[model samples]
Target: MTKTVEFYFDLGSPTTYLAHTQLAKICADTQSELIYIPMLLGGVFKATGNASPAVIPAKGRYMFQDLDRFAKRYGVQLRFNPHFPINTLILMRAATGIQLHQPQRFAEFVDCLFRALWVEGRNLNDPQTIAAVLTENGFDPEEVLALSNDESVKAKLKENTEAAIKRGVFGAPSMFIGDQLFFGQDRLDFVEEALRQD
Candidate 1:
């Protein structure tokens, strides 16, 4: 039997970016399939009555410090974006569109956007900047912009967010191994253990 890990994420999240970088290897090592479910983190928070830790001054500071430690441990570099709180609506929509229509390019889209938002610290909120990034990544900015506006893609993103809330997802970087939900990049060890169990 093949195990599957459902990863619910948003590009706006640095922690989710960390999980994105790690989950593939974990799934490969465990002989599990990693499924990426793109859902708006803000939508998840609204549905779950939760707010980002960044809303809390002390927690926000501590979270960044802790994330730095994790990056070191994971051997991945993450420079917090100065332009955070980026409106990821279009970005997440682009992701949903890629996953739905261009499955093979799904990882590429994820990698590009994640690095743009988290690593390269690009100001993704600027339309021209986003378009340039997409074009530089070998994607047609206009085509993806069209897809982001597609009715099906918009609905799919909303549906995914609703389903995530129904499944008890309160935030991004939530992983489900079977019916067990693990929230946060910090809980990935538990996710790996869950995958190893079956």
Candidate 2:
């Protein structure tokens, strides 16, 4: 049986976006299943008493530069958003909705929003901006917004965050090969190695 790689991520995290670009191919090559788990980064931080590396000025600058280097190494486009800290509650809720409802289109929605928030540097904080992005991508903006507000979707997202904290997750781009938890996009090599093991 193929091993499963559970990817716990939040859209507000650029590293999570970077990991997403590579994990699919990694799973394909390794005969593993990639499962996407959506959670709120802020909630995780609050639950674990962990803060973003970006909270420090020098570290934040260097982190972005490192992210760009990784993007180059991965041969993927990644432009840093000027709007640094985007509140992704609605976006994440929408992701949970897609995962629960339109499973077929989950990947597409993730790619679109990742590009919009990171590559294209769109201001997704604005509802109108989100609507435009959704409309431009041929998705019904109103429908998606409504779905994002669903009670079940909200609770699922909450559960994801709580479960991640319980699993010792303090940041985005966390991947699990069985119960081995790897944090950060840079740790993907170790994750691959874990998958190769019996």
Candidate 3:
């Protein structure tokens, strides 16, 4: 039987970006279904009393170097965005709207957005930049951006964040295989192992 993996992530997370790149291959190899669940990391942290590693002095100092090493190891491009840790409310709402209205397009938008943020150092929080990114990805920029401001979309994003907290998720790049919660990009190997279990 094929297992189902739930991936909860936020674009604001560089670690999540790294994990996202490898997750598809893991799922394909293991014949598990990958369910992408985007939620606001800030909200998750707030509800779960969790803090970002970057907020810790030592970890914050080490994160950039670690990301560099990890990026090189994964053979993925990683660029530091000048606007690191920008507000992701609009982006999260946009994602929720896309998922609600067009699931396939939502996936495409997420892929492009992640590449833009983590690879190209583009400012995803900028409206013009986001619109351009969407347009370049063959999406209707105006339509998608409009959804970013939709009340229902905003509500859904909030709901998703709450759901993550209720699921005991304290951070981004978390994955659930059955009742087991694997936190952080580094824990992905554990997730893969869980998928292999009988």
Whole-model lDDT, model 1: 0.93
| Model 3 clash tally, residue pairs | 0
Ranking by lDDT: 2, 1, 3
lDDT (10s digit) by residue, model 2, range 1-198: 789999999999999999999999889888999999999999999888888889999999999999999999999999988987999999999999989999999999999999999899999999999999999988899999988999999999999999999999999989998888999999989988888888
Tens digits of per-residue lDDT for model 1 on 1-198?
999999999999999999998999999999999999999998988878998898899999999999999999999989999998888999999999999999999999899999988899999999999999999999999989999999999999999999999999999899988789999999989999998984
Positional deviation of residue 117's Cα in model 1 after best superposition, in angstroms: 0.9
In model 1, residue pairs whose N, Cα or C atoms come closer than 3 Å (at least 3 residues apart or on different chains), thus clashing, are none
Q: What is the Å distance of residue 182 in model 3 from its true position?
A: 0.3
Task: Show model 2 residue runs off by greater than 4 Å.
Answer: none
CA error at residue 107 for candidate 3, angstroms: 2.1
Q: Which residue ranges in model 1 land beyond 4 Å of their true spot?
A: none
At residue 131, give the lDDT of candidate 1: 95
Q: State the number of backbone clashes in model 1.
A: 0
TM-scores, one per candidate: 0.99, 0.98, 0.94
lDDT of every model, 2 decimals? 0.93, 0.94, 0.87
Ranking of predictions according to TM-score: 1, 2, 3
